[model samples]
Target: MTSKIKNNTEKPTSGIRAIAEELGISIATVDRALHDRGRISEKTRARVLQVAEQLNYHPNRAARDLRLNRRFRVSINFPTGIPPFFDALRSGIEEGALPFSSTLDIEFHSYSLPYDHARNSIQSALDASVDGIIAVPPNTFQMAELVRKANMKGIPIVCISTDVPESGRLTAITAYPFNCGAMAAEALFSHMNKRGSVGVLTGNLEYLNHAEKVRGFRTMLSQLSPAFSVAAVIEAHDDPHEAYQGVRRLLQSTPKMAGLYISTANSISALTALREAGRLDSVAVVTTDLIPELVPYLREGIVKATIYQCPETQGSLAIRTLYWYLSEGMRPLHFIGVIPQLIIRSNLDLYISTNKYIAR
Candidate 1:
């Protein structure tokens, strides 16, 4: 038989085909030998194995093993009691995982606690011997340590929505929060003609995403419009009631506040407060997310604009990145930045169904 080998040093595209050509064997025999199928002579199998190794032949390990194994466990950890934005993220991840179900085994863990308790949850996941992990940004030093431990154990990690600094995780699929903040501020000032005093309602500043947005908003506002001043920044801690009360307090204290920039998921509460006070038509409001509760307000002109970060895309990308790292041993990109979308009532229809945040 004519040998299939040609003068090519690159890795072969097909393992069985490469083996057959390398050994002058039939394709059927080569397939049996490569897969350890019965009826192939030991001598022939040995030859095929040697050829496959020399040619750098590889198979889809996950698929190959799925015939025998039931699952390939992947763990997801996130803070509990988060709003619909996170629910959207979970839905995206679950949808992406569907195609890999034959080989992938998924376990989801949710943590609802103070910052320290959240870190402990991550640590527990690390100890659970999962094949890989996807996590929301962690708040405390313990969480960072758990990430380091996971790396040591050779488990890949995907950070979604927010990120932990200096954690050396596999990949972070998120938007540049600070730049988004700056952009939101720019949108607000443009709508208001850079004439009014603005106040900021925000979540906890410790989270990387939140902190970055605040920084970007402040920096951009200072550089672009010196005339428009930020009267106050109130932290709502991602609580709806707190956000509502904070906005109320801010409006009372900063009576000249002609504009409001809410740089967090608590925009729903802020919108409600603005509506109740009947200040929506008077004061310009710009926020983040397309939460279900906020949609009517956007339609009614109670909220002016929002910055949309597609959390679904973030979740899906994070899991896919982790899978790539695990299967191919590829290093993830240093900084994966998802583009932020500017949403106004005019263009809101296109994004209404997505898990993206609407600022309105």
Candidate 2:
């Protein structure tokens, strides 16, 4: 875990100029090191940061905010799904950007694949000359090229929700899917009796988050429930209708299926399939996300459990990380994984209302 820097409650005094003077380096070099731009050696960057810390040289941005000369354009692109999940995320980003209103300009961009039929919303962001990006990229090798292009332009990228770790992003802010999947599997296993085949419903493997979740679920099942083998691993493309059909197919093929593990937020459809199959009570099911659609199922004892990845905090941290890097030259950690919450019928109400997914 990356330790957070304590906010110095003392009023801000001094500026980068003071630190530059003491370091005896050109102000431009100091600026590059602070902003993590240009070709500066590790030694100089460390030296500049150390002296800045000694003098408590925090930039006084109130004046800069007034000028509004240095405007930052940030683009947010999320997957196509229920509004509550993405809406909660966007709300946090808007909240984090509130203090920097004068100097920041945000534009929300929509992107989808297989469903929306558009594979290049990210390219559009680049075409529009966005200074930075926050996105949920599909689990595909093609994203590597886009990320490489962005880095070449010095445009920072932060991946949210699902991450493309190999894309060379500034950082990835996520509710760690591997652990989340394992948690969901453990919940499902505990609720199930002795031995029967359990089905794993996943989104497209092209999305890294969905793939990571399946990996975690499978790993946990192997470790915990050796008797319950995964009868089928189906990809639902994260679409509600598609997930419904996929589950129905699983039930048709595997008549003795005892449990279902859904690794994405398409539960409303999958649950419908289960109910239609008349096996809702017979088969134990665990899903992800605490959206409104899934809530009713949990309350009625139809859906056994869900794993909630706090969308608000993920969104808030993505914006804040970029702002600190762009505004204050704070170099964020490459990967910061936030653990997800295991939501059962009893604790469902709290997670739905409070948005609290802190590490236990």
Candidate 3:
């Protein structure tokens, strides 16, 4: 009994603590150096590693697994307006979290178009003390403050679809908005012979994504030809009724308008207005996203093209990024932009069948 007790209390040197003791460093430094995490000095890390190898130390896999067994609560905050696009995002989030369902409890917080609702949802998540957040930042200055609070509280936040660059988000998973807009402009130009005024119907330009698309569309058109000019940048606010009314007024006011670019996923509303105004067949239109509603218009050649901004992929990646960070303490890149794809009538059917959420 005496021999056994002595052996137990001897501090038998084999684990991370032993390495710390041998090097006269803290256990945290030893661990960080061993895992190659955080911002530790390379010289110290090298020393810690050398001592770990010399001692023939190996981490206990069973113990590490046990330590990581605790469940994490992650909040998903997004806006609701375009059902097809936002639904795809939700599906991607769910599918991405499926493999780790046992380890994560995902809470969804969806708000409507005013964007203040989104701000409130994020605040609620903060109050609940969620482990991580995946969100689409509202077009509000308050978003920056929310991001600051989350960062201060040691909660990582990832943005999807759009971004607030100054908000200190962990990462943004989105399409290159500028490129999406430029692609639309090119498509419209091709259909219009680069000599007609194009009307841009979009959401609030205060949002970075919307503004970027407008800027890209305008810039590309300018480069294409001086005769090709932007007639108007109409703000439909992503409202079906407002979009319908807004496009109707534009078509009436600008009878000579040769093209229309629906920069948001408000294509159906705008298209209906155009059809009602007897201008759908006349105006060469470029729309955003490929929803079932837009399929009929595309096949009939009423829409020249639609920019596909992989909303499903954005959702999946956002959750995956947050999960890896929370589980393994890995840092994700600042921005992960999904490349946008242009879909016309020819390629529309292929996307319709394979679109993950659409098929579901």
lDDT of each: 0.74, 0.79, 0.83
Model 2 stretches with alpha carbons more than 4 Å out: 1-68, 115-119, 355-360
TM-score of each: 0.79, 0.81, 0.82
RMSD of each: 10.3, 6.6, 9.9
What TM-score does candidate 2 reach?
Answer: 0.81
lDDT per residue as tens, model 2, 1-360? 111222223333346778878988888888777667799999999998898889767454423544656767888877666566787788788777666666777788766646333238778888888889988887566787788788898888998887777877899988998888898889999888888899988878877788888889889988996898899889988777888888889999999998999887777888888888899999999988777767778988878888888777888889878977777657799887777988888987677566532211
Q: Looking at model 3, which ten-residue stretch has the lowest summed lDDT?
A: 1-10
Q: In model 3, which runs have C-alpha deviations exceeding 4 angstroms?
A: 1-67, 356-360
Per-residue error (Å), model 3, residue 182: 0.4
lDDT (Cα, tens digit) per residue for candidate 3, span 192-250:
86477789999888788999999999999888889988888998878889899888888
lDDT accuracy of residue 306 in candidate 1 = 83
**Given candidate 1, what's the lDDT at residue 339?**
92
Candidate 1 per-residue lDDT over residues 114-193, each given as its tens digit: 55566666677777777888887654576678788888888877788788768878878787898889988888877676
Residue 231 Cα positional deviation in candidate 3, in Å, after optimal superposition: 1.4
